[model samples]
Target chain A: GAGVSQTPSNKVTEKGKYVELRCDPISGHTALYWYRQSLGQGPEFLIYFQGTGAADDSGLPNDRFFAVRPEGSVSTLKIQRTERGDSAVYLCASSNRPYNEQFFGPGTRLTVL
Target chain B: AQRVTQPEKLLSVFKGAPVELKCNYSYSGSPELFWYVQYSRQRLQLLLRHISRESIKGFTADLNKGETSFHLKKPFAQEEDSAMYYCALYGSGGYQKVTFGTGTKLQVIP
Candidate 1:
């Protein structure tokens, strides 16, 4: 693909349900990231992956929010026992490691009811 | 410990007027700064990076290492410039993980 891609542009789920947000990074990019953005706010860092392993996840708000990039090309952000506060736009971005510009997807809006 | 702060949530300016969107960062290490823009209903895209020291769409950002700031500025704002702007900082968080500011909504009124 020419750019980063996210699935199901919008999702609405009831609290306590599980939801998975998918992201497809640009082919061959070695770095992938997940961020969350609340209404009228900028994206907040959640996690970063270098290949199959998460290199840094300190930004994740809690254990309820998790992300995985098993093969480095595609990633998924999983929210377990979703809460109403989890409602926001989940964004995915990719870059070619350090010193490269990040390309972001259109984002997936997750609305927890 | 690392963070980016964009003070304004919204900014409105007339076409052809000068515009500046402030971005300040807090990080212990050297910072690589960038400006990302999102137009209404469009994907987020890179506008420019301080390391490149290049201007795109008549906008430029100067990174002041001493101040830990990378503010985007344009001498003349255009109606097309009306969009959302986010400032970010990337560093050795293993693979260049970036921290972003809250973003500013730039509304250029004609």
Candidate 2:
């Protein structure tokens, strides 16, 4: 019973660089979500995927942020031209269904210098 | 737009004292509310959902639709209760969008 897991627990990159954060949800989880949490703030939802399609991506801050969960399993959050403001923890969560309790990953700490 | 608000950023209480965390949300349709807690060095996990109506770890939250609030309460706080608590809201919209409030840090002093 592996829970959600995010790779590159800590990542550091220069401003204007591109970075990607990956997440592996629990087996059999059909719903996956991405969120970003800034210091001293709550997680801000980025996007959600049901099966293979993104159900909602309104939380994405700007055009530079994008995510995909193809084949309905692993997900990746990509940031183009990362900015200093993008320094935060990128969290991923998954659940068996939309209404079920979600399980979260440890989160990837992304730092844009 | 739907929003969840946690008014207090931090709350400290002595051991055995009563504890309460306030949460308020705004949504037009029926909403699903949940309390998620994250202990030191641990991933965020669900504590309880309003739909279940069952207390977990001596903590209970009553959803007051009229007040548009869901407040978590525990009669006797313990040192282990120290953690960050987040109130989440899920609207009835088709996308199943979920929103979390700015968490509240609970400090239980022994």
Q: What is the C-alpha lDDT of each candidate?
A: 0.90, 0.95
Error of 1 at B45 (Å): 0.7
Tell me, by DockQ, which candidate is best. Answer: 2
Model 1 has an lDDT value of 0.90
For A1-113, candidate 1 gives per-residue lDDT tens digits of: 48999998999999999999999999999888899999888888888888888988877999998888877689999999999999999999998875688888989999999
Tens digits of per-residue lDDT, candidate 2, A41-80, equal 9999999899989999889999999998878999999999
Compose the digit string of candidate 1's lDDT tens values, residues B32-63.
88899999999888999998999999999999
The window of 10 residues in a row where model 2 chain A has the poorest summed lDDT is A66-75
**Number of the top-ranking candidate, with lDDT as the measure:** 2
User: Which 10-residue span in candidate 2 chain B carries the lowest summed lDDT?
Assistant: B90-99
How high is each candidate's TM-score?
Answer: 0.95, 0.98
Mind giving the per-residue lDDT tens digits that candidate 2 earns over B8-30?
A: 99999999999999999999999
Backbone clash pairs for candidate 1 read: none
The residue ranges of model 1 lying beyond 4 angstroms of the native Cα positions read B93-95
TM-score of chain A of each: 0.96, 0.98
